[model samples]
Target: FRQIVVEFLRPPTHSDEQIRSMKAKANFPTDIGRRLRFENAFCRAWDLNLPPQQQHDVRQHILSYMLVFTTASRMRGIHPDGAPGLFDHTYEDNQVVWKPAPEDAAGMPAQAYGMQNGSADRAMGCLLV
Candidate 1:
């Protein structure tokens, strides 16, 4: 018999609060609600969990430091084993300064993983990005 691959997408249709209430009723309350934040695609991308006016402000404040932290970690020679890939950066542009690497130095994809049959449908939810 041949293996069958069936792909599906579950839209974020239930609010975290709703999920939490359901879980608590089932005696399986969890912290997953804290991470997922919002339930819908439009809200998630816009980070609408925050007040409308504060969303842009919050995102700008945190995003500025991401590049600086990554560049500093690289310069300090603190790379985790085979990590940060082979790319470098030039803070002048705040972008990854890509360059060619030796063939053997190229990074390889990590092991593949998938949700078990029961929850695969939910976990396979699609996102535009």
Candidate 2:
């Protein structure tokens, strides 16, 4: 899995500092910075839930989900909708989906004729969340 990521992408376009800024974007409305921190801890450790105060921190709770989504986006088995291709509970009742469809030879995602369509916004959607 590590090989797949290292094999394909260039060095992360985000520097450690840029990534840091993303984590520091904490005010009232955005909590990603706080959440990204502990979300990383649990990724390597066991399934330990964040402590209640920590978990309830508006900043942490929201960013925790963002952290999960961003991290999962790197794996090959994840669907464009942010669902785990091989794992269960990848999505939830109100999770907003932002998946891309297959592209054509012209190097563009196929268009969907539906009420809700995929958007290029998926790439940066994590920021707003």
TM-score of every model versus the real structure: 0.17, 0.23
Worst 10 residues of 1 by lDDT: 56-65
Model 2, range 68-124, lDDT digits (tens) per residue? Answer: 232212111223233433322332222344333222211221121101112222221
**Residue pairs with backbone overlap in model 1:** none
Predicted candidate 1 versus true structure: per-residue lDDT over 26-110, tens digit per residue:
3122221113423333233111111111111101111001111111111211122323223332233123332232222212221
Give model 2's TM-score versus the native structure: 0.23
Clashing residue pairs found in predicted model 2? 23-33, 31-59, 32-63, 35-60
lDDT for each candidate structure: 0.22, 0.25
